[model samples]
Target: MTYRPTVRGRRLARELRRLRELQRLTLQEVADRLDWSRATVSRLETGQTRPKPNDIADLLDLYGVPSPQRDALITLAREAGQRGWWTAYADVFTGSYVALEDEASLIRTWDTQLIHGLLQTEDYARAVITAGRMLPTTEDIERRIDARKARQALLNRERAPQIHLIFDECVLKRPIGGPGVMRAQLEWLLELAERPQITIQVLPFEAREHAGLDGRFTILSFPDPADPDIAYVEGTMGDVYLESAEAIASHGERFERIMKQAMSPEDSAPLIAEAARSSP
Candidate 1:
């Protein structure tokens, strides 16, 4: 099975690499010692494959990792290998993003196009996916919609992530499914804004040539500080997950600037309400 690692999975991979380097053992040397293929060791360190607890224990023993640390890492390996709900929609969630999103403690997104996916209503999602993807079959579209609904459930779960969304004002005016669907979506946004964990802001058209003009990006912050923040950018060609400290800092600053320019959640609520009332 292809591995789409969650935050814990990534942390385990980093620990594995660090331990091997600390022992001054090359991948080939470790593979030869364990009578395993070099590719297997490399894949384990790079998180290309799900780690088995037994394999992790073997590596820990070889590295002279003590009982407590070894036991901790082995536990992590087990957790990493356990499939998440996203596995059910493996075709739809072809990346680690959904897995990461499921565990994020804070989700900050800056978008110049449509509303954030978690905030989208069913009708709006259908229109957007149908138009944006040009999916050939109805089954394909519904599968994605189902996957999206499944993903949205994270917001309602106990200890839900604090979501801060800043989208371009044009999104409110875009009649995606139709006037009625768009209106309902806007009203839905107003209702969602009432929730304590969600904050919705709109960057008006007048804020031209702003920091967020570069395009949309999402920053996922995990509860565990060891995991580090990830800046994600989705594009037609592919998706990019930025983890370097410099990249995270850059995106963080840009998002702050965009937030500064955007209407406050209080002001944005009125704007969204007005948009819903107007003829689309």
Candidate 2:
């Protein structure tokens, strides 16, 4: 299984590389000194491999990291190495989205297609995963469904993230799991909208050629300033995680524009309720 580095993992990787550079040692020199392969050293510095505490200790010793920073980084390495709930269904979720999403304190998203995954009901998720993934086995489909269910638990946690969703009008009309399933999903959306932490908006067709013509994306903000914000773009080819300040700022502007054009949460509630009631 490929190790998808989390924010802490990436931070630890950067620090390790910086420490080595400070000592003016090449990767080969470090590997030779530690009796590790050059490739192993490279992978650790690049976050391509999980950092073992012992391995991190050795690297710190080589760099003479000293007590304060050395202990801190080793602790970070242990946390980075810890497995999350999603790891159990690694085959289902092939990216770090779930892992990162688990850490977010706020989630903002714009959807041109289906409903946001967090708000999706079990049946709706099953439908989406089945049709989109083309899984060959019932067991495989169930496993994916289970993973999505686990992910939704984040919303109900004691300190759940503030979630705001802006979806195109067409998403309300698209019946993914047929009329009955779609109706249930929409009704659930209505129920969830009543929550204080959740906000929903609909971008009507009248607003033509808007900023969202590009596609859908989600921005995740963390409580810790050190973690920074993340902008995620999902694609059929592969998902993209944008962390740079410029990239995040650009996506932030796009989302703000989209939100401006979308119906207010108050106005959107009636529309969502109407869609749910009208769905037969």
Candidate 3:
């Protein structure tokens, strides 16, 4: 199926196209140099096909991009490839999540309500979307739910990015979709916790002190030599993308503080299991 590029994805694609033009290299010329099909290069530059690492490397060399510029391009390529499952639900969700998910090499998420998108079950996703009174038709909601399901695939990749998730105790106690849905969600969390690359923790409501109490945010870190880190904060209308060094640094510090305040993964599992037992 054809995909509509997210705003951020489109922006990145335009940047790549501009770079190519500045170098005075035609698409066919670059393709011939990389031994890749012209269509492939065209797709990458047009944001049709997501750019892969190898493709970025070849393009950088072909374009004679400097080391710093090459690294940035490669990072953008990696982010471009991260079309999260959410893209499928493009009709529902704003494009912000897809863009942020794509560029995040390491994601630190804090969930105060439903399970984080990366860990939600289909049932949980449905419940969460349906709960949104402003959402449109059921078909659109289901599409978004499915898109969220697809996004989970990234966590299962062989070289999946590191995911550190912190949840408030309310997420466990407050029944989103009800007992059955919440139970399933907890089970899914338990299953996800088994993955070596994922760390799940919960901050008990009793934890009088917590950095995340003010609000929730995610810090997305990319591989080296790229533009500095970014902070994604969501709201009712859309989301904000913060890339300034000071903003990124502040979010990083807040994430570290919240991580320290939350219970350890080892300790959090039993709590999750206990919640699951009591769920429905």
Candidate 4:
């Protein structure tokens, strides 16, 4: 199975890098000192490989980390290696986005072709999975649909993330799983818009230019100040996550401009309702 790093895995990776920097040690320097290969140290710092407790202890000793902090980091390494809910669907979620999203405190998304995954209805999700052609068999598609529905549980959790979704007006009109499915999807959007934590907007075709013309992207923010915001861009080939302060700020500005071009939640709700009625 492909490795999808959990939030704890990410946290551990970040901490390890910070510790190495604090000690003013290069990857090669650490590798030589520990009698390990540079690639091993690099992978651990990059979250491509999990760290062993003993290895972490050795690094902590070399980095001069205090006893209390060393113990905490060792415990964190163990937690980071544990699997998450998405592990069962590893074939589908080969990336770390779902794991990061699971722990996000806020999610801002912009889509031009389809509804954001978090807001998609069951029928719509099934249609999307089938259309993607990523899976070979019907059983795999069904498993993906079930996994997607399970992911929606995050919305109803006690401390749900603040979700802001902006999509192109065409998304509501482009029939996905036939008219019946499209109608249900639009109706579901209307219902979801009523939630206090969810905000929906539609960018009409009338807009000559928009910030989101570049394409779909999502920005996820965590509750912890130490966890930096992530800007995720997904494509047919693969996914890219931008974590630099500049990337996060740029995406943040882009989302604000897109929100300006899109209809407000009040206006969007009526448009969705009308589209639902027109679906056929």
TM-score for each prediction? Answer: 0.98, 0.93, 0.72, 0.95
- Better structure of 1 and 4 per lDDT: 1
Candidate 1 residues lying further than 4 Å off, grouped into runs, are: none
- Per-model C-alpha lDDT, please? 0.93, 0.92, 0.77, 0.91
Ranking by lDDT: 1, 2, 4, 3
Which lDDT value does model 4 have at 227? 88
Better of 2 and 4 by TM-score: 4
Model 1, position 149, has a per-residue lDDT of 98
lDDT of 1 by residue, 166-231 (tens): 999988877889899999999998988999999999999888879998899999999898999999
> TM-score of predicted model 3?
0.72
> Could you tell me which 10 consecutive residues in candidate 4 have the lowest summed lDDT?
1-10
Clashing pairs in 4: none
Give model 4's clash tally: 0
Best by TM-score: 1
Ranking by TM-score, best first?
1, 4, 2, 3
Misplaced by over 4 Å in model 4 are none
Residue 152 of model 2, lDDT score: 96
Task: Assess the local accuracy of residue 212 in candidate 3 as a C-alpha lDDT between 0 and 100.
Answer: 82
List ranges where model 3 is wrong by over 4 Å: 1-89
